[model samples]
Target: MSVGKLPVIDLTPMRAGDEFHKRALGDALREACVHTGFFYVAGHGVPQALIDRVFAASKAFFDQPMADKRKVDKALSAANRGYEFLGGQTLEPGAPPDLKEGFYIGEELAEDDPRVLAGAFNMGPNQWPAGVPDFAPVMMEYYGALLELSREIMAALALSLELPEDYFEAFCTEPLATLRLLHYPPQPAQPLPGEKGCGAHTDFGGVTILLLDDKPGLQVWDALNERWLDAQPIPGTFVVNLGDMIARWTNDRYRSTLHRVINTSGAERYSVPFFYSGAPQHEVRCLPGCLGEGEQPKYAPVTVEGHLREMYRRTYV
Candidate 1:
């Protein structure tokens, strides 16, 4: 079956017991990954109510006055959690700061946890805003749901690569995951030439699952056509995309396409993107069968922690 610029995949067959259906779904996923590295997922089984609650919580938190939101400034957290005001992040060096404010959350770890005790980067407790009483609970619930969904999707991706469905299981224990809530305020009618809600860049982790409101701001770079294509929002679906780590693992067979947000709709936009990665100590080497005869691996093996730390340093100003 021919797919459009972006395909919408139903994940129901992945949960079915029949091997035939599962393989078919895997084949579809492989096609999408090789071609675009981006797709919309439906029938993912995440409760709509949970999604709504998370969005409501995000709105409530971002709606607070600037002074109130600044109390949990991300600059104060060693783990990069908490609120990041506008101009705090610059995805592309030398570019203007992204015109968005965000709140970052990660798995909560106690001060004495082994990872925390070892001073592992990005493995620590998150800073929650005092103003939004329900934000922490709602976001934590949503994060757990997305993490489960990511596991299922990872299994499908493994099958697509002709690997065992559980091939990634070992690497996922104590994974490094983050849920980012972003708010882009309305832009002027005629803005500066280079101003954008977000600069063009690819994600640094294994995969990103994004929940977007009804808006037309996201755009994906069409490398083949040398044009930008709108990744318009579709109700009840999450926009799933491959990240740099996955592309490296696949030996460049799969793309980690560049994407950016520009809120030209003149309205506020909110999105939640969950980034999932393997355990920090796991080294990402080119996968078996990803290379053919005489094909060379394009990247050297790197530990998840090292790569992520470098990326965070470059992007988070």
Candidate 2:
């Protein structure tokens, strides 16, 4: 029961059609959520070839000159797409800017889409880099695939919470998902005081599926022990963690722990983290079984879009 290290959960059982395996997997997921809120997931059906292709495209895109990458600056995109250079944002309030660069992509909506017409935030076209010819295509493919995987995982999570498997379907019809490709350059031997690759903060969405390179830099704060534990990368698997929205939905039964990255690996570190959340218009309320007898709800109902907009305002420069 010691939640010292992140747990590894095989997702194959949940994906399989066996009811027994599904129930078992749900049980394990429930425990992991309550204890650690983070885990390593294997057997997640995404093809390794597809993952590799995306990584390759990410590197190629980041390898471009600063001017080339800046052509699609996120500041120019109303939908929060495009590239963000190092120090453009700070995840942890009052901390120095993050020492990393990243490209953000989301579901590409056309100008005529109803959501776009309504001026919905985060519901418009993504800005593709002209320098990397194959970056857009490869990233789009990965996004479409991961979106489906996220739904499947959500179903499993619903079951773990003692709700019907399809309980979350309504909230996902127009998911506000984001696929971020991040590159952390080799850190200086003596970094400025208070500088970090990514500052300590909890994700603002529902779940994060992270694929990291072998070089170690990510660390999770162990609140139980008041210490930082390395989230070492594992081959052929991804690190999955719950986000603040999920913690709120479950009335704090699950954790949304603080985590950060420090790239002192003496090598450039690349990571792809897909952040999946509910539809912008969906209202997140406390689930039925989350509150114990006579326990008051810890949070008020909030719309996904409103929460995201506020979080973005705080983080972006």
Candidate 3:
């Protein structure tokens, strides 16, 4: 039923535009979401050539001189779009900072865009590193592809919950998604206690679409089993995981599992994660189906932007 602990779902059936098969795909998605909150997506329609190009660009950008990378440091951008040096983020409280350097890209907006004019959180143009001249275009192309795929996955999620297929249409419009390229060096021979490539934390958004390099490091917390399970990288598949907002939306009927990376492969590792957080103004509330007859909502209503700001405050503070 599953590749390992996580399900391997093929989107090809749904891509055929068959209503019957689409609902069948939704059923499988519901199982994976409720059980593991993680899965591998195959036949997602992104060209392998494009995927390869994006990886090449990521490595090239990260391979640039540290001074060059710092020229586009995330601190320099108001919207938090740029390079983040290793150990810059502490995802798990009390643990050592994550040992990964990353670059963030989001919807390319102009200085005069209304969202930018209003000074919305994380709204503005991206700051690209000029050292890797082709990085921006390659990353943007991959971003565009993932955006389309994210919406399709959202629609399928709606069907999974027995909602109208367009239930999340508004949320997908003008989304506050982010595409992050991360590079993790091999783990230290004598690592600090609790140190990891990425600290254990649940994602903050709607859904995350991740492309991983062949080196192993990813681990998903198995709450029921009370152990960490390796999420091995599979060729031709992207790892997909639900985020905290989805758990909030579903009243926790679906999980937002904790996951981290611990690159022990003795080689460099690179991964690209696209966070599909939905629209800034979209209000997230418990779905009717997610609650029992007398169950109360576990969380209060919050807009996407508000939730993200709160999550960022907790992790970055």
lDDT of each: 0.89, 0.88, 0.92
Model 3: per-residue Cα lDDT over 1-317, one tens digit each: 11256899888875786888888999999999999999999989999999999999999999999999999999999999999999999888899999999999999999999989999989899998877778888889899999999998998899899999899999999999999999999999999999999999999999999999999899999888688889999999999999999999999999999999999999999999999999999999998699998889999999999999999887667
Per-candidate Cα RMSD to the true structure, in Å, reads 2.3, 2.1, 1.8
Measured with C-alpha atoms, the lDDT of residue 301 in candidate 1 is: 92
Residue pairs with backbone atoms closer than 3 Å in model 1 (clashes) = none
Better candidate by lDDT, 1 or 2:
1
**Model 3: residues with Cα > 4 Å off, grouped in runs:** 1-4
Q: Write the per-residue lDDT of candidate 2 for residues 148-193, one digit (tens) a residue.
A: 8889889889878878889999887979899999999987788878
Give the runs in model 2 whose Cα sits over 4 Å from its true position: 1-4, 313-317
> Compared to the true structure, candidate 3 yields what TM-score?
0.97
CA deviation > 4 Å runs, candidate 1: 1-4, 313-317
RMSD from true fold, candidate 1: 2.3
Q: What is the lDDT of residue 279 in candidate 2?
A: 92
**Alpha-carbon TM-score of each model against the true structure:** 0.96, 0.96, 0.97
lDDT of 1 by residue, 34-67 (tens): 9889999999999999988988999999899999
The candidate, 2 or 3, that scores higher on TM-score is 3
Cα deviation in Å at residue 224, candidate 2?
A: 0.7
